[model samples]
Target: MAQCRFSSSLLLRLRSARRFSSLPNPTTTQNDAELVSNILLHHHNPFHAMESSLQLHGITLSPDLLHHTLLRLKHNSKIALALFHYAKSLPSPPPLTSHAFHLLIDIVAKVRQYDVAWQLILEMDRHNLTPTAATFLILIRRLIASGLTRQAVRAFDDIETFVLTRPTAQDFCSLLDTLCKYGYVKVAAEVFNKRKHDYVADVKMYTVLVYGWCKIGRFDMAERFLRDMIERGIEPNVVTYNVFLDGICRKASLHPQDRFERTIRNALKVFDEMSSRGIEPDVTSFSILLHVYSRAHKPQLSLDKLKEMRERGICPTVATYTSVVKCLCSCGRLEEAEDLLGEMVRNGVSPSAATYNCFFKEYRGRKDSESALKLYRKMKEDRLFAPSVHTYNILVGMFLQLNRVEIVREIWDDMKESGAGPDLDSYTMLIHGLCEKQKWREACQFFVEMIEKGLLPQKVTFETLYRGLIQSDMLRTWRRLKKKLDEESVTFGSEFQNYHLKPYRR
Candidate 1:
């Protein structure tokens, strides 16, 4: 039975290895340079130009010229394919080399025309021409890049038939990475163990497996792979340890409702294990533990980790400071968070958008709009962290609540000028505020603008508009808007389920 299986496999390989295409000689163009120039000039209309060149101008299609033209349209698959089809339209098609065919296949695959590309391969096979291994490798990699990992695996399965040379470890690693990326770690592991004897297992291969195991929360299997590497005399590097540390920390510190304390303890144990294994903890190691401590609300422990990193001559990264800042903000230590922000800048670590958002959120919660505005100006002046839509939304909403319409308008204008263009929520808030103030005309204008921008106002937004129209006695305007909205299939309803609208107690 084993002999029969081997024979069947051999036959499959031989059949798959048969030539995909063999083309007879085609007509040649007199002036290759002139034809190429004409093609280049009309690359945007590649197919049309190719047709005109052959059918109208009586210029024969040259494979070399077609190859050059296709290269120019490499980024645009549709145009390249059009040119390809035009070349094949001639009585004697231009002779396409293996590289030319590979380029066309790659361009077609990039645009996700897999069916058409497969048909091209079948046509190639009909012509008794075989593609090179490089061609298959390019196709496989592109397929994986396009998130067609299953197809890539199929391609990988039959890759042996295309390439004449031995497959490299890099090639196998790419396939393993793709498999692991899509949560096929078990299959990847099986393939690795089975094929490790065929190709020498490099550190990257081991790392890929360890990462895959850790990614799926299979730390036990990850540790087993680590031990397997050690047994084979392959020492786990800092990257490998970081992966393990990150996994353990993610489990322990992230979920407060879970066994948070136990997880933190587990993470610490992994950290200590790294030290015991003579692998010195790096910046990433410290960052992971600090993040765990911060998320777990252990601010003192997080601060201590920061101090330890500093004394050890390991300057804190932006992430390390950000974690501590976030912890401080969560604990309502606003003053300390502010001071820490200054210190972070002194240490040459710029605050990220998240850092600014955290402080802005706290300030808005406390109704300290003055402080928030100052922080906003400071953020703008610093220009390190560009303000996001959330930042603008908070400021706009706060100003509206304070009945500062002019200030809100200024901020809105600034938001637009700053390139953080208003989103649906921004327009909603603005329209709601304007309606509350009985500014029906202004509110209607904004509503029109929102609709023009393809932003559908929520039911609350329509309610606000309706109430404003009733209060302002704009029945005609309200009727027109209602008619338009109904025509657009917009149904008016209550506020979003997540939000409860309170009634006015007179």
Candidate 2:
């Protein structure tokens, strides 16, 4: 379904391209301008193509021709900017519309060219043309995003006076949501308070405020917004309640003792209120509850909620299943976790990295190296979940524990084949494991490989190698290793020398 949606969207874009192609070119001569325009349309380096067409073929490009070309390349800001510069340099500059300026400004602002974009705005003002509200919004969003909060606030403060269009609830929400997301909840509230009267406030705007306040742990402010929404005769929807529930549960987990106990009770009260208010609890609602229980270490309650949710015909999602699996693992119910993993797969719910990691973790916790190795193989064979660095580390460690050092090389090869080869930790573990088994030759080889890759070996790694060589009475190998270390510019304290000469014993 996702692939189909992507394909459909791509087809729509191709159709749009065709429509763009059919538009009348404003250039005088059809041949030269048409070629440049076509080059801009099809060629990867349209700017270079346009220059080559001009220099090599003596093609004369007018600003009007470039203007039409700019329209085609508007989706690509970098290309549009280049084309604009090319057009602006012509003897007779094309008559660009205010709308065209807005598109240019918007594209530049998106790429964080705040200074350049602001200069364009000033130029637009010098021409006595007012920027559209969309342009101001884009600039304000960029300023706020790039840590220029004061500038953003100032711009937003003077937005109504500058931009002619009446600000809509959407503009307010866009700015407010952005402000809230970046830990500027107070600024968001201030913006809301200042602009609420200008635009007809909607449920989404109120919810944004509520979510923002809740995110910053200001439950009082969040509730005040909720009440304001209610007084304005706006019915709070499922999303609104879900925000409160998620906030409450998250806040509950932060408390330590008595406060922690009460906060959880309060979360449960919110859940009860949700049901009492006749808003059917969806997967999100249940996921929040399950997550809270998992955090609180109440796996039984999480399982019970899962069963109850199933009975209510609310199918458990991958997130819900992952949390439950984690809880089961934490509570030492490995068998139940495995059973749930099977049920999850059978029900068409693909296991995530976390789900597989849970089993790996439990097996490792129980010191069952063979079981962990089998689980690692199953995870790779399934191909549904991508093995992370932790997965490789665990499998490599398991091979070492089982005294199967020969298999370690094969696992390393497989890890590289999977495209997430050994990180520093992987090399360290492999080198340490090989040294422990007195595989001095392989250890030295891996050590050199690690150094060549620019992954500096740890002090422990050097100690392990030096100690291993000394213990095996391979003094010649130790001297060669020390010389290699010197050549690599890897420094060590004089203390290591004392240890190296001390003994060959463990």
Residue-wise C-alpha lDDT for candidate 1, range 126-171, written one tens digit per residue: 5567755566666776776677766776777666765456677888
lDDT of each: 0.74, 0.75
Q: Mind giving the per-residue lDDT tens digits that candidate 2 earns over 1-506?
A: 77446534433432332222244454433433444445444434644634422321222344344545455665667666766666555665545567667767767777788877887776777656777667677788778877777788777656677776566778778888888888799988987888788888888998888899999999989999998998999878889988987887776654466665776688778778777878788999889988877777678888999999999999999999999998999889988998999999899999887778787777777878778767767666867688777777877887787788766777888888888878899999999989888889999999988877777778789888888788788889888876777766634344334434345575
Give the TM-score comparing model 2 with the true structure, all chains together: 0.65
In candidate 1, position 465 carries an lDDT of 77
RMSD of candidate 2 to the truth, in angstroms, is 10.5
Candidate 1: residue pairs that collide: 20-124, 20-125, 20-129, 20-130, 21-124, 21-127, 21-128, 21-129, 22-127
Q: Model 1, residue 160: displacement in angstroms?
A: 3.7
Q: How do all models score by TM-score?
A: 0.67, 0.65
